[model samples]
Target: MTRVVFAPDSFKGTIAAADAARVLAEAWASVDPGVSPVLRPMADGGEGTVAAFAAAVPGARRMPITVDGPAGHPVDTAWLLLPASDDAPDGTAVIDMASTSGIELLDELRPWDADSRGFGQAIAAALDHGVSRLVLGIGSSASTDGGTGMLRALGARFLDARGAETAPGARGLGDIASADLSALRPAPEVRVLTDVTNPLTGARGAAAVFGPQKGLTDPSDQQQTDAALERLARLLALDPAVPGSGAAGGVGAALIAWGGTLLPGAAEVAHLIGLADAIAAADAVVTGEGAYDGQSGDGKVPSFVASLAAASGVDAVLVAGLIAPDADLAPFTASASLTEVAGSPASALADTHRWLHEAGRRLALAMRGSGPASGS
Candidate 1:
């Protein structure tokens, strides 16, 4: 039997990684009954990180909680608890911004107003549960508050010049005077996860690189927030030049200040889920994301997966919701785009499951040498 491993990141807003993997596997099986499809959904410590862990680890448990959302409203969510192991006797808790203070929770973008308090609240809950280790995925945050809101939630106080707490989110960055972390919960052994590697300040900083996407359109607003974050870094005695410090709107730096280590999200998740071993044993590995663009080569799921496949002499195949014009597809044995298959971006997103099946069938056929050319 031909062994194929299906490992794909969540399709962002369209589909969860586990569901996508299941759909793809079923379609591939239908197309080629001789194929042994292994479903191994993946994540880069983003939106579906906890769900990915839950699916991969048999004894993983979900601990439910409600916390302040990005828009300052209560949002119900949960953190994942991986059962105790020798490395982590008390268990490891998985928390991420995507399910807590994530951008998707907002009705609309509130670059200056959306705070990361919810993310911090979730972390605090995990800590209270006595998890000895933390795997924090600091991605998809809605705020650019330099992690102030999160710190506040963790018992660190960001006070104004008048000795009062500053307003929430980026809107209050300019009002900071001093910080008091004495009452803050000391961080346990923690590993912060993210695909981003930008520094905390300057041209490639959080404010400069991701501000616009979060709706910080005005040049003046970006400048102010950037300055504020730089000041915060100085106040907390953290280095602003640290790579990955700019992740999740300065949450990376904040975690560093709280004594957490930053690690590559995709690589960490791969190790956690035993992706490398699976690829080594498979004839081919298929991986993808919601969008494949020039940025896909940078520590992303598809690129990382392809590299592993190459080292193991396993063919790597790519499928994506959309492949930008400039995306380099050199590492893939074959590639497919749901947009091209569905004939439009809207339709593809509207019905991702259907196109995913089609993509899987085409990929299986290509491997069998009975399908037309693979692009799209």
Candidate 2:
């Protein structure tokens, strides 16, 4: 009997990762009745991180804390505590960057004119919860202050060249010429989980890769943003050229400076879920996310899972909502295949189940070597 493991990230607006896994599991059961299927939902420490963790680890506790959304409003967010120290009783807490400062929350609160004050508060709350190690999922953030607000929430201060406190948003990023970490008060054990490796400065840095998303327009101002990031780094007494420094608006940089270790978000979570063991034991491993493209290769959940499966001598397949040109991930996995659902992008969004089933049938047939000539 074939042992298949289905691990998929959320399909974004379409389906949850668990639901996607169910769809794949049902497909495999229908095609190969004897196959044993394992379902594992994955996340990049972004939007569904809390749900994914809650599903994987029982006794996970959740507490609501107000944090700065992308635009700087007090959005009600959550901090999840898992099995940790004896004093806390609850496990280590999972601090979702998204919960406090995600794009969705930003949109709801109009983040363009806001700051990240609440994000800082959320982190402080986690520390107060007696969390042994704070797992800061630094993705899907709404702020472009390079985590200035996040640092502020932890007691770090951003000062301008004139030595005045800067406002807690990107607009004031240009004036930031220094940082003061002497007053910072973060937990002793903190790990930042991020997918991006871009630095906090330069052309490939935060302002370049993510500024536009936060409504930055002037190319000249990008340099200022980079400078602001560097200033923060200097305040923390560290180098800003570190990889992942640009993640979540430079939270990675702030975390590193503040004694937080940086880790690959998806890979770390996968380890927490015993993904490698599952891959080693499976006859075939299937992984995917909301979308697949060149970016997926950069330590994204699907690509990371593919890499693990390949190392374990397991064949893998990628099934995604949208398949871009470089989304053909077979090149990276030793014996991998890529398949997309049928229907236009809009149709797929409108009727997710139909195409998810279609995609599943197509994948199942491919696995059995009886699939059609083309997915088109």
lDDT of each: 0.91, 0.74
Instruction: Specify the poorest-scoring 10-residue window by lDDT in model 2.
Output: 331-340
Q: To one decimal, what is the Cα RMSD in angstroms of model 2 from the true structure?
A: 3.3
Clash number for each model? 0, 11
What shift in Å separates residue 295 of candidate 2 from its native position after superposition?
4.0
For residues 93-160, what per-residue lDDT tens digits would candidate 2 score against the true structure?
77777777776674443323455566678878877766667777877777677677877888888788
**After superposing candidate 2, which stretches have Cα over 4 Å from the reference?**
32-35, 85-90, 108-112, 159-164, 176-182, 331-340, 373-376
Error of 2 at 169 (Å): 0.8
Q: Number of the top candidate by lDDT? A: 1
Residue by residue across 110-145, what tens digits does model 1's lDDT show? 988998999999999999999989999888889898
Q: Return the clash pairs for model 1, or none.
A: none
